[model samples]
Target: MEALLGIDLGTTGVKAAIFAAVDGRPLASAFVDYPLFHPRPGWAEQNPADWWQATLKAIRSCLEQGARVGVQPSAVRGIGLSGQMHGIVLLDEAAQVIRPCIIWADQRSEPQCRWMTGQVGAARLIELVSNPALPGFSAPKILWVREHEPELFARVRTVLLPKDYIRYRLTGRMAMEISDAAGTCLLNVAEGNWSSAVLEAIGLDPALLPPVVPADAVAGTITEEVAALTGLLAGTPVAGGGADNACGAVGNGVVRPGLALVSIGTSGVVLAHAEAPHVDRSGPTPRIHTFNHAVPRAWYLMGVTQGAGLSLRWVRDYLGLPERALERWTDLDAYELLTREAEGAPPGCAGLLFLPYLQGERTPHLDAYARGGWIGLTAAHDRRHLIRAVLEGVAFSLKDCFTIITAQGLQLEQVRATGGGAKSPLWRQIIADILGVELAVTNASEGPAFGAALLAGVAAGLYPSVEAACEATVRVVENTAPRPELVTLYARFYEQYRALYPALRTVFHALAGLS
Candidate 1:
């Protein structure tokens, strides 16, 4: 039986999974964690060598698991990769790492973002790239390096995203795919290629970028060195995988129109597949993102919330839940305990609301200066109310994305849920009630790794196309419908949630200045 390997270079770790190419059933999986460096406030970086090391460790562990399950490692037919998007990895002429990779979470390029917007003209920038300049994108990060570290920028011969760098290390090839490249603020999203005009505006050469390809296309074959390191065949094909969210969408079988995906990890994303590119640059508010989908020739609309699960994590650590778990020597998760506590509180949290902008917000509002806190809190509220309010706040933020998507003329029939937050029945029900749409849970638990494996199956010709591959492997496992009474109650609370941002904008800016 032919098998496939899918690897995800995630923010905090690398995950590797082995799957049957014939039916997409997961055979074995392994994960290896890595540290994210925050040398300064609002700055996040990771050493690329650490990612490669983690990838090798994960693959070997996964192969061992497969062997114990009676699957031959040599039967692995193809490899696919998915990872965090917009990270800038610089390489010298000899393909040596120039510096540590600046990841998507870093917010140090705000000044560069403003400079790019000024140089290209805000309206023309949107016209050329189909999105506004933001601090998290690759273009601004490149400009930041050029202005701040001119000597290091001069040595840069090539720029690659997080996964493409891994692909380069695996295959000895320099290439990128459309889905991940779209987030760089360099791609002409409508044309599905790098924008020369934008590059010129930023004084960058087109040669600095990698060759773009479709997400499912075969990028190259594994090198002998990589094969010897991981115990795999040297010539195994490597597919041009996708960005994490794009692969997650593919993993959930959200390839066609009308179906949407809501993924809540450290950050939250609400995405809808589009038959054609839908650019909405008319509004003053930075609302949604238009990017090439992992499905060839297709597009997607995405809205992001920078702090989704992060808010819950902050609360969990603040409440000493993990420490308490350690003391009891229990295998119970801190999030599960938090969710159980939330269940004790009534819906709406008796007028208490939370703003989940711990790392600033992205969707609807593009304010990096925004801060998070509990509003409408009273002496009557307790820990249950605080936990419930956090959950409701996240749901409310996603609802903001849903409202914008509907306003853009895309109809959402059912929302497929994925990621760490989806495991909670309470969170799923809360999202359903808040959005007033049914929530679906898929059978694939590995998220992007499963999607990457399916894409590898497509590249190997095991399936005729991506859609067919998803249809063969993906299935809806559970459904949650909204309750009428809860939906009515959330409508009023959502109005209050919407007003908090506008009222706090001035105060948030002032607080940021003071800091």
Candidate 2:
């Protein structure tokens, strides 16, 4: 019984899932969490060593579970990796980690972003890399380190993304997959390689970057050392995996045109598959991102909400203390308890609105200084209204993504939903109605990990191609359609939601300054 291993290096944890190579059914999985360090406000960092340790434990536990199901370690034929994008991990000459990885959520590179725009002309930069310089991108983070940590930066011999660093540990190889590389603000999206022009303009050494490879290509084989540690077979092929969103698109079967994916995880993304690169160069800075897809020769346009599930998490931690206490004695989850209460609130939250800009605004706004808060809060509103507003606000922000995709003439015939937040029935209903589209959930519940497994299947010859693997395995098991009355109400509320951002833009910047 041949199986595939998919390892997802997420922001908070690493997950190892074993899947049947023939049909993409998950066999066993294990997750091990690591802490995210924020030494200063607006800065998110993680030790790559933690990721490596957690990954080994997760794989061992997953394989142990698989063994109980009659699968052997040697049964695993291939491995695929998926992870958070835009985070930078620098390795010194001795292959030693020079500093903690600056993750995607870190916002310390605003000045570097300005420097990028000043050096390479904003419009021309977009034309070169198919996206604008954002604080979260790898290039800006690199620049930040170059200036702020010059001593450490000088020793940087190689730069890797979160997952690629894991791959290096597993295989003793260093290469960046194209899909992940595309998010670096250094890759030429249409060409599927590092952009020399962008590198030159930014004064970055191309040599510090790894060779680019296709998502399904065999990047390297697992080393004997890794196999000994994790019970995987020595020389097991490891596919060049992708960024989380790219793999999520593949996992949800959004590989071709006319299909889009809506993922609500720590962050939120509305992505549409495209055969050709689509750049939003109309504005001073492009609103959406055009990145290479996990599927070879394909591209995707993605609109991101910096805080989607993160916003709800804030409420869960701070405001739902009662629910958390109750959870100790009950089987109901704390989030579930909150959502049930939120369901009792009216559709429009009685005119309350939430802006899910807790981290910062992405997609249409592209403002890292923008902060999150509730608008139209009144004495009449309670916790239910606030909770519901968070849900509705996330949906509305995603709608901002959907609206831009359609306006650009991308045909989104179907919307597939994935991620932690998508599991909520209430959130799904809100998103479906707010977007005025039927949201479908596929059987690939493991999200990016499952998608990574499918990519492994292709690399290992279990399937002919990524599309064929999806055609064989992924199917929509549930659908949530928009209710007409709710759709009308959300449409009105969404207009008001749109207005709040622009109105608060100046104030948000001011608040950011004060902080």
Compare the candidates by TM-score and give the number of the best one: 2
lDDT of 1 at 362: 81
Would you give me the overall lDDT of model 2? 0.92
lDDT of 1 by residue, 113-201 (tens): 99999999898888888889987788999998899999999999999999999999999999988999999999999999899999998
lDDT for predicted candidate 1 compared with the true structure = 0.90
Please identify model 1 stretches exceeding 4 Å from their true place: 322-329
Model 1: lowest-lDDT 10 consecutive positions: 320-329
The Cα RMSD of model 2 versus the native structure comes to 1.3
Report the C-alpha lDDT of model 2 over 1-515, residue by residue, as the tens digit. 98989999998799899998777889999999999888976888999999999999999999999999999988998999999999999999999999999999998899999999889998789888999899989999999999999998999999999999999999999999999999999999988878899899989999999999889989999999988898898999999999999999999999989999999988999999999998875567778999999998899999999999889988987886464447563777777777887987999999999999988878889888988999998999988899999999999999998888888888778999999899999999999999999999999888899989889889988888999989988999999999999899899999999999889899988988888
Q: All predictions: root-mean-square deviation over Cα?
A: 1.6, 1.3
